[model samples]
Target: MSQAALDSLIRMAPVARKSAAEMVVEKLLELIYSGSVKAGDTLPTEQELSAALQVSRPVIREALRGLQILGVVETRQGGRCSVTDLKPSRLAAPLQFLVGLDHDNVEALYEARLTVEGELLALGAARADEAALEHLEHMVHEGHRLTTDPLAFRVMDLEFHHTLMRLAGNPFLERTAQSLYHIGAEVRRVASETPGVLTNSAREHELILEALKLRDPERARRAMHTHLASILRTTREAMQQSP
Candidate 1:
């Protein structure tokens, strides 16, 4: 971009005087939201940003770090910072920090799945293509075959949920649900370790598949609800038993 344009974009509003560093961050975010800067675009160098915003390099770097923490931009090797793809799931990067990643908060991950994924399943039941259904069927089969192996079973379980979300064709829902799935990994692993959990999960997958095959939205929703609820119960029991 031209220096003049960059300068105008980063110029602080002429109201109450906030710190230049904070204004730099606010204006930078404005550019992103305004689509003046887009995903996959490399931001101007720190020197350029510093010059444009009339802020010190230290202040510019600090602003950039805040954006990075939000998953808004990524710093590559050699100091190149680029805007990220802006996936909705990435927005939840602060959850672990804000909630504290322990047993209690980890449970939020499971609740998030149940809350978001039920809708995805209902939507997927109507929108899923033959290819998506076939892939989901394959995952169910894999889950059955891997029941004796907790790690393999868990992998299949996670992939199955991700695929289900993707099948919904709602980018925001898929992204948020995928993030929750990842965030709840520890709880999911614990649930998988519970006796008969994998077996029950595999069977539940079949029930979901059956509902999906019928193209019944309500049935699919019920099936997903049952499946997630089973795992939630198992995790709760495990937590109760823990020291």
Candidate 2:
């Protein structure tokens, strides 16, 4: 860290709080997100951070540990710390853990999925080119063909949504939807056992792809909404029927 950067961080030193380590973590994140420290850049030593932030070295160490677990930073063999690439998978590690912690909150997870995936769908419809539309069409066709094969169909289902997220060109929302989707994986396995569930999902995927083909954002959003609602319903039914 530069002297100027150290001075800036000192100015925003965290006040006493119940979780001082968390506060320190936030401050350090500010430095990362604010572009003061880029990926692969070495973070200041614990002594430097402690002195600059006016916090104890132990607190700084604790904060660094938190960052490491969250995949934000890595400590190399000699105790030097550097920022990670901030890839979606890496950044989403903590969220994936949090989502798994509350298995009963199925509705909450779907609601969040609707918000994130809906936007991604709309953006994909607006921005996808001919090649993207053609690729999605192929995925939809595969969904129909694989309806009888739950395992293969489930993999295609996930890839279909992942394709849309990539089309939206937003890494953050993509990761969020990915995390939310994983939360329902077990429930989806149960739902897939229900005879009509995969068939309906295949049809809904077709509807969504149709809207995307027309390049209609609002229509695409409505299609996505219907598809998600159907999934939620089947998930609830599967949960009720679970042993």
Per-model TM values vs. the true structure:
0.79, 0.81
**What is the C-alpha local distance difference test score of candidate 1?**
0.79
Which residue pairs clash within candidate 2? none
Off by over 4 Å in 1: 13-24, 38-42, 51-59, 65-71, 74-78, 84-108, 241-243
**Candidate 2 lDDT by residue in tens digits, 1-243:** 567767778788454657889989999899888988788888888898887788899999999988998889998879899999888778866466655623378788788889998989999888888887888889999999998999999899889988888888778888777877777587789889789888999899999999988989999999999999998988888778767
Question: How high is the CA lDDT of each candidate model?
Answer: 0.79, 0.84
lDDT of 2 at 223: 94
* For model 1, the run of ten residues with the poorest summed lDDT: 92-101
- After superposition, the stretches of candidate 2 with alpha carbons farther than 4 Å from their true spots are 3-17, 33-40, 47-62, 69-71, 85-94, 101-104, 241-243
Residue 177 shift from truth in candidate 1, angstroms: 0.9
> Candidate 2 has what TM-score?
0.81
